[model samples]
Target: MKTASFPSLRVEPKLRQDTESVLYDNESLSQFIESAVRQQVELRKANTEFLARGLASRDNARQTGQYVEAVDVLEKLQNRLDQHKAKHTTK
Candidate 1:
């Protein structure tokens, strides 16, 4: 595969030293930076999706004048947690 060069990133000496200090034996600085950038991109995408879902829920509630009671929501969440715990504990 042909790889093109990415823009050069410049950081302070202390930041560079700190980053290098935590790397594994087989890891390279370029690989670490690339991984960090990829993680950040994924995190931003997830945040965007979360915001969209929240906005859609708000619009739906406004249109229908319907919303779940907090107590009901909490009960459902607790039930899910309990079910998950039971499954994991038996494994």
Candidate 2:
């Protein structure tokens, strides 16, 4: 497959040096920047989906007049976490 290139980026010398300093052994600067961009894209996509789901849930609750209390939700989540930890704990 043909490959495309990102536009050249201009940054301060210190920032360039800092980024280079963090590069893994034998890893290229281009690879590092590409990985960072990919990670940010995924994070933004996840955040957008999370917000959409929450909004949909809110609208559905308003329409149905069926809502869960914050405390009750938290308590149930805590119980689940406790159970998971107990189950996974080494005896």
- The deviation in Å at residue 18 for candidate 2 is 0.9
lDDT of 1 by residue, 19-75 (tens): 999998999999999999999999999999999999999999999999989999999
CA RMSD per model (angstroms): 2.1, 1.6
Error of 1 at 3 (Å): 4.2
lDDT of each prediction vs. the true structure? 0.95, 0.99
Model 1 TM: 0.82
Candidate 1 C-alpha error for residue 41, in Å: 0.5
Candidate 1: Cα lDDT at 72: 100
What TM-score would every model get versus the actual structure?
A: 0.82, 0.88
Best model number under lDDT: 2
Top-scoring candidate (TM-score): 2
Pairs in steric clash, model 1: none
Clash-forming residue pairs, model 2: none
